[model samples]
Target: MPNHLVPIAFELPHITLRGLTNNLTHKPLIVALHGWLDNAASFIPLLTEVTDYHIIALDWAGHGLSDHRPPGTDYQQFDYIDDLHQLLTEQKWENVILMGHSMGGILSSIYAATFPEMVRAVVSIDAMGPITTESSVAENLRTGVLSRHQRRAKRSIASPVPLTQLIDKRQQHTELSGELVELLIKRATRPVIVEAGDGGTQVVWRTDSRLRNASLIRLTEQQAQELMTELSCPMQIIIADDGLLAKRGLWQQREQWFGSAEIVHLTGGHHLHMYNTEQIWAPIAAFLHNIST
Candidate 1:
């Protein structure tokens, strides 16, 4: 029987993070991470095929039911690594595998590099490493600060919208099919009382607006390469034929950074694991088999 997803939450010092798990604790654990704007439900498809491992897919802070950052604080790229560290340390989990998609995949690589002993392997889907920049520090800083200010100035109460409309809007930004988009959007939104006394509620996004702001800083290309060199665990990178890292020769260039890594190319869009679970899971299953032996 396919495992059922159980709702779970982690209480950290500053915020509470929520997630869904397959609840198979007897098996080895795989803590899954979703991409930008997506929540834990993004892994629902994979949970059906990945019954061999105990999987917990988290809703990054401000993305799903997780608490947004404290007042006056904006979201930063590197702070996610710290959040993951706190959750793992509190749970006392060790030597586990990390499965991440897109932004999540980037974080997995950096986290594994930072603390290689905690991660037994890493499964990165459609992402090889962190995006790097060649722009001058002054220029990057200025752009990021301006972007945050613009977002803050534009913030306002969003009008309640229909569920179908939310899915339509999200699909416009990605190649994911409507069904796939709906799965994620459902978890990322909540119902709010839109009428003063009519007992009527309408849906509104729960994701923090600060997430759309430009990153305050990014690793330079040299800095990104240096961090990759610290990674020593076996890594499996599943590249989608039409995904962001689909450009030929990209993965090959970064191949040398890992102690042991292999690339598997599958046919699909960026969120292939959701719509193409069978094809995506085969290589991942094989990868895990190879690791166990």
Candidate 2:
């Protein structure tokens, strides 16, 4: 199918949200949020299946073409919730259908709970709510402060490299197919002029280096439970059979947190949505259809 997606930028006071949208005139706006270190292009596969509703896939604050956070500021998980709130308010959106992957999925669930009346439904892929920390409060706070300072003080600009090398490097870490890797490279990189041999230019990942820093803090088990219990919309969570949730024994506990949620298991790794798009799309489409009618 021909690509019908349009690149869009949502300007905010602090940072701009970069994303792609399709069929903007449609109702019940569907917003897709990508996983950590990923960009809006992660949702391109769904465009072929989810044609009935308007869709917007965002690149969060520091990913893709979006602006990075101000210097000296750490990337906090809650900051995403604030950004989403601003985006929805600016667009005058209500009862939105949110679909998120990995970190995005966690954020979407938190947002739905925080403002239950604003979300119609939620589709979480390979994650559910926030991951709670078992560390003591004092220890957690101390570690967070030290880590943030160390990361900020040592931050440096990323050197540009050939696109082919970038793809090869990423492939070593994940089982993503060549096609998907190429797609991500296209969305997450830009050409840069080099002062080398022939003064040639190369493409580099456009993500902010600060995004690699560890989260400043994490929700406690009690906090995560509270957020999950507060969710008022229909929810669907898809976990890959070999995914992180399964490995860490979190699926059962996470599933119990939601009052109204259905859980399904698919066959793939953490990024099942990118590699097994068709399988992932079926459940998502069904959830959206059921909620809309």
Candidate 3:
């Protein structure tokens, strides 16, 4: 945990989103969004490197300390944008800059396109835009429904495990440094009574299980491109040479969608922003400088 990062929460009518901020006073607003399964702590390294702006890093609903959607409801991409809009409206903020990583980057791009007036610029790390599916609508729907049902059927209270063991598991899966993984895991777990009448307790992950379910539908490649074309604000996309966007190679074809966006390529893994903090910040700082002037 960065000593400067302060924990804050926004209370919306339906849900409360939790986040960390370096400053809350009047300054250019830079809203940071983390990738799927990652919470606000994902930006701890990057946020520590920049202190001139009022930066708020949010834990998307259900991912971190944020409130989960009402029961029986499913998570959707559009809902996140709506939540973001509501937050900004409640805060009376406008002309903001969005800095996001991976899934966060994807959502930031979509939001910037949808509401260009509210966004002054966008910084996307390891993401270009929405992911399109080649599967037919019916097939996609079927897969989505079946996946939900399977998840619900298989849902069982996870047995309490040693926190270190859990941290180790997450580090292996994410390939992030143990320190980084520990920072995220500590925020995403809670202690629970595992043995009745024995005063024994253990910690379990706090992430909403429903988050693992697949999205019911995805935009087609053409539809995604059309949406990307609507993004008029200045955009900076940082590509990790070894990240998901690079691995997929789809961003190469989509570059034309954004007429003249600044694209920087760095060498690192998917979570490059977290591990390669300084390397990632150089381009971002320059981008901010260019936009501010």
Candidate 4:
């Protein structure tokens, strides 16, 4: 039988998060988080490949079907940690197994470090930890603040386009298969009326465009190292052979921060978890199994 994914929404004090889950009755929750501009749908392929545990894949705030932050407020990297903490507390989930991809992987590492007691294990794909800023401290802060100020007054409604065009555009950039592109388009867009030119209706992305902007603050290399040192839970860092980390010579440094964590190199792109599910699942499953035993 095909796995059934139940749509769920968590109403929090600050924002509402939309997610999809399978087997809520199972213990030791596995939370899957997606990359920037992507949504919970990104995990569908992976979820379908693994059915041993209950898993919930969340659309981060301002992405997918989740609620966006109030106007004039930009998305800060640390805010995601707070949001996840609140969600876990509200749901009374302890000893969580975080499975995060790309940007989500970075957030997962931070969360595991920030609240080591609550996490049982972390499975990070295509990213080791938070990205560090190389710019001078003063310049980094200045640019972040300036960008927010400049973008605050420039908010505008996005123009709608045909669904096929949206999928085609994403395919061009990500090189994702048509099947995966269609799945993302379905979760990330909403139908709307377009009164200009053709005067027909179409779909537009549901994610807050502000998310495309850089964060207001970023962790420095020293801070990231500190965070990595604080991680007590077993971690699994999976690097794709052709992904960004491998290309930039950063994957070689994974052992420095995650000394005890298991590192595996596979053949695929950054989104291997979505595109090459089987290749990625074995290591993650083995890690989870070992921790549980």
Pick by TM-score: which candidate is best? 3
What local distance difference test score does each model get?
0.88, 0.84, 0.88, 0.86
Candidate 4 lDDT over 19-119, as tens digits, reads 88886566558999999889999998888887688899999999888999987677889989999999999988899899999999999999999999989
lDDT of 3 by residue, 13-63 (tens): 889999999975677889999999989989988888886788999999998
Residue pairs in clash, model 1: none
Indicate the residue-level lDDT of 282 in model 2. Answer: 85
Q: Candidate 1, which segments miss by more than 4 Å at Cα?
A: 1-3, 193-201, 247-249
Clashing pairs in 3: none
Query: What shift in Å separates residue 186 of candidate 4 from its native position after superposition?
Result: 2.1
Model 4 residue-pair collision total: 0
Q: Candidate 3 has what TM-score?
A: 0.95
Q: Which ten residues in a row have the lowest lDDT in candidate 2?
A: 193-202
Off by over 4 Å in 3: 193-201
Better of 2 and 4 by lDDT: 4
lDDT of 2 by residue, 1-293 (tens): 23688888999978899898886665568889999989988888776566678888999998988888987786789999999999998988988989999999999999998988889888999898897898988888888887778877886777778777777788888878877887787778888865565544578778877787766678899988987888888999999998989988888876668757888889999888876878888888887888768
The C-alpha TM-scores of every prediction are: 0.93, 0.92, 0.95, 0.94
> What lDDT tens digits, residue by residue, belong to model 1 across residues 168-244?
88899888889888888878888775555544446888999889888889889889999998988899999999887
Quantify how close model 2 is to the true structure by its C-alpha RMSD in Å: 2.5
Model 2 lDDT, residue 184, Cα: 80
- Comparison by TM-score, 1 against 3, better one: 3
lDDT of 2: 0.84
